[model samples]
Target chain A: MRTTPAKCSKPNFKIHHRPIISAAIAKEQQIVGENEIQKSGFNFKKYMTEKANSVNKALDEAISIRDPPTIHEAMRYSLLAGGKRVRPILCIAACELVGGNESIAMPAACAVEMIHTMSLIHDDLPCMDNDDFRRGKPTNHKVYGEDVAVLAGDSLLAFAFEYISGFTVGTSPARVLAAIGELAKSIGTEGLVAGQVVDMVSTGVKDIGLDRLEFIHIHKTAALLEASVVLGAILGGGNETQVEKLRKFARCIGLLFQVVDDILDVTKSSEELGKTAGKDLAVDKMTYPKLLGLEKSRQFAEELLAEAKQQLEEFQSLMAVAPLVALAEYIAHRQN
Target chain B: MRTTPAKCSKPNFKIHHRPIISAAIAKEQQIVGENEIQKSGFNFKKYMTEKANSVNKALDEAISIRDPPTIHEAMRYSLLAGGKRVRPILCIAACELVGGNESIAMPAACAVEMIHTMSLIHDDLPCMDNDDFRRGKPTNHKVYGEDVAVLAGDSLLAFAFEYISGFTVGTSPARVLAAIGELAKSIGTEGLVAGQVVDMVSTGVKDIGLDRLEFIHIHKTAALLEASVVLGAILGGGNETQVEKLRKFARCIGLLFQVVDDILDVTKSSEELGKTAGKDLAVDKMTYPKLLGLEKSRQFAEELLAEAKQQLEEFQSLMAVAPLVALAEYIAHRQN
Candidate 1:
């Protein structure tokens, strides 16, 4: 069996709560498929490091410092700053799982990273989240000034499409167009932007329940993550069934990532995390930990992870699915 | 002979003004080539109205209000707001000149307009130009708060590529890919974004010369216009020679648009012009009228128009090229 709930759950847990993805958890976790896969000895840390390094190299080559240095500097600053490279890695791994190699996925991998970086930069603006730091450095607006930050964000967004459309080699134009459509849908009003506006609107309003919270997280965080995986699969020539399965897998892990983030907010100190901790509690924002008790939240995370892993079991080659299984576990277990 | 040095040329009109496109202008203005073409009597005003109406209809159908209300509302507000529809018209006209129809160019036409609208929204932001009104009403940020306005602009930008890549039908994938590349390049650091940064940087600097002014205009204004025309040519199956000639023609007219804009700055009042007139001079910003002086700027405008029309002389079908010639004259003559 898994570890006892007592040892895993936070001591400060409160029981008065709403059901957070409990239905999804019940539906998705019937089979503990990934437990066996995990025991088969996959070194997730090693896989992540190797993939992250390659993605970094590709991203560096994708964008170089050019004329009008400030915007480029701002772009490179946020882009190169250390993140886990999770989305690009997910993209690459998904591509590989569908019988494509790393080279076929690199342009799209870099493009997703660029889109994520620009979103972060824009989200941190003074008029937006007003955050002064991101990824352990001053935010784009802080370092480059708001004007350049805005332009840099806009430039990065535009260039992501340009890079994907112009730079992708060894792929059919049909697949490329499909990938572009997916990327565009992820960021538009019905996707990332839609989530952002509602999240902003939800602030300071009473009765922001678990459903509302999930809507925001799914749109703001999960949408792009879904796009990342789905685009990779498409670029790799995954068939309809394969693409749909991976999309479901991506959505679960995407939500799992946010639930874990909310849990960490209450459990980790700012010094340990490197960014402001307990920001959710301070703002009284709606988070999983706020809606459900910390214990239930952790349990919810596990259920989602299990569900995510179950989707991967459909792929016949267990070894090919190892990296993705490892990724879900990483999201479930990361400290910051 | 053209107007003499006294009545038209600004006293400050440096006779040695780099002979800007004089050879091309001389070659192009040969009446021996198209003087009879001028007598062919194309009705530009009627052509513009009909084409603009169709393009506006396509653009309307291109984006619609959906799920989350506010962001969609903001997007629709700016996109559907009536402008001159110049870029879309240019795209369609270029396609027609190269022997293609409106249907083949509509997606790209709408895409270019989307890009232009997004740029205008961002440029009007408090962080950017801080303008309070645009397209005859309160700007986007004024209508839907700044946060939503920024997102709206971003959504529009992303959706432009999506609309082109996804909705475009009856076009070859190679042409689609080429169009995407050209559109992306027109908006990135080397294109529209570059122009914006330089224009921002040049605000208060001393001795802003004509070269710097041209650099700003070429990137800011001309790049997208060139993209608009060239993408149309590519989509219409224009040969390399046709594409390159149209590109040059577009570049001339694009600069002509800005030159006329600067002249209007000095000549029109804020009431007469929808936007703030004389704002450029008020800011002590660099402008064509300021450097070339009003009379000489007009002469430059005329030369550029001649140079643009000359490029179309190679088309060999005068009636087919009439709309473009009429567009050049329109840019030179538009009041607002």
Candidate 2:
């Protein structure tokens, strides 16, 4: 789930009167460890660490300080500042699940991470969300002036397409073009930008309902996540049916990721979250918790998780889908 | 030549003590209609009008007002706002010159224009050049607000890649990928972004030299021009030698475009240019005319025009090369 910092300050708006679930109670309801991971005996924790480390190394190598040091420095700073590597991990997992090796997917995995980082940088700009802190460090605009921050984002966005088109190896150019198309759609008007524009307009709008909220999250958050998995499946040689199934699975989790993010915002503190927490409340922004009540939001999250896992069941190999199952759980249970 | 509006006001810096050429004298030196166009009898004005009309129509069809109307509106507002359509025209002419039809290169032509429009939107942001007007109209930020303006630019950038990858037909996938790579490299840190970053940093510094000024324009201006022509050549099935030659030809004209821009800044009025005139001097920014003096700048432009046309001589068909020869002259003599 992506975290966009609050645009304005203080909580003057009233909260919903629905029964609220405390943070402790939400944490106690663990959602994973069902028939999926146990049957496959997948060590998800170890797998995530190995994949993240590999992704980190690949990302580090993808960009280098060149001609003008400042822009490259700013790009590397935010990109390497570190997140959960959720998108890249998902990309690699999707590729491997469809019979492609890690090496074949590495370029694409790094490309998604780059796109995600670019989104974060742009969202944190003062004109957008006015974020001061992200991932426990100052936001890109705060460290680098707004001008450089903007350019840094632009540079990363351009480089994401370039890297995918120029560096992906062992894949047919047709598949690579298809992957590029998928990735581009995920970020353009129909994807991340759509979500961001809606979110920007809906800020402090008290009457916003579940449909609009879902629209924002689905476009802003779910679109890129869908692309990450879809790119992997396409480049990994997944057939049409397999790619479509995985896309649906990704869409469900993408929404689940945002719903959990809304839940955590109200539950955690800034220090624990590594970003400003309760930002939605402070800004009076509509969130899953605000509309559904904390308890109902938690239930909604669980339903989404179950729905996401159900899409993977038809694959007929519990072992192949184990990582994705654990990933949904990880996103749900993550503290920061 | 692209126009970047001035960031600040008042020209307090001292002008270089060098001989200057009057605008009338510069205009008197007609640089074309010599051996190239005169011999081939290509109607340059009619060709440009037809090509521009085709490109504008394609651009209109490329983007539609979709789900979130504001962002798409802003994109269409600037993208469809009238300009010379130089990049797209160059793209089509180069493709045709390389023995390919216009339909085969239309997607790429529109893609370059989209990228160009995106750059202008970002560069006009409050934090960047802070221009209040562009293309003789209120800037995008003034019309749509900064947040939407930024998103609009982002959408266009992402869509450029999507359109090229998704819409280009009759071209091999490998060729499509290569074209995407060329376009991406023109906009990233090593391309347009690189030039903007340096230009931002050098905004007020007075000791800027010829080398640094060239660096800024080459990356900022020439890189995209080079990409436009190179993409056309590559997509037109040009051999490696032909592509490399066209690349060098583009580089010459790219620098020539900027040099002419600097000269016109000192020589034209805002009303004549349709955008802010003398912005370089107003901001005390380094420019070709500032460093080389107007006379030397004019002389230098002549050298570049000659060199740019010289690279086309090896094509062995004067009929095929006339458009490029006339284009180099058009870029040199355009008032705005």
Give the count of colliding residue pairs in each prediction. 0, 0
Per-residue lDDT of model 2, residues B211-234, tens digit only = 578779888998899999999999
Query: For residues A213-317, what per-residue lDDT tens digits would candidate 2 score against the true structure?
Result: 877987899889989998889988899988887887788788889989999999999999999998889998998888878887887776666666666766767
Q: Write the per-residue lDDT of candidate 1 for residues A1-336, one digit (tens) a residue.
A: 111121111122111232333546545554534466678777778889999999999989888998878889888999999899999999999999999878889899999999999899888888777887776688988888888888999999999989998888777988988998899888877578877888888877766876567778877888899899998899988999899889888888888888899999999998777777887777667777777789888888887786677777678887788888888888999998
Best by DockQ: 2
**Global lDDT scores for all candidate models:** 0.83, 0.84
Report iRMS values in order.
0.9, 0.5
Pairs in clash, predicted candidate 2: none
Clashing residue pairs in candidate 1 are none
Residue-wise lDDT of candidate 1 within B66-132, one digit each (tens)?
7687888898899889988889999999999998889999999999999999999888899888899
Task: After superposing candidate 2 on the true structure, give the runs of residues whose Cα lies further than 4 Å from its correct spot.
Answer: A1-33, B1-35
Model 1, docking class: medium
* Worst lDDT 10-window in candidate 2 chain B: B5-14
Off by over 4 Å in 1: A1-35, A38-41, B1-18, B23-38
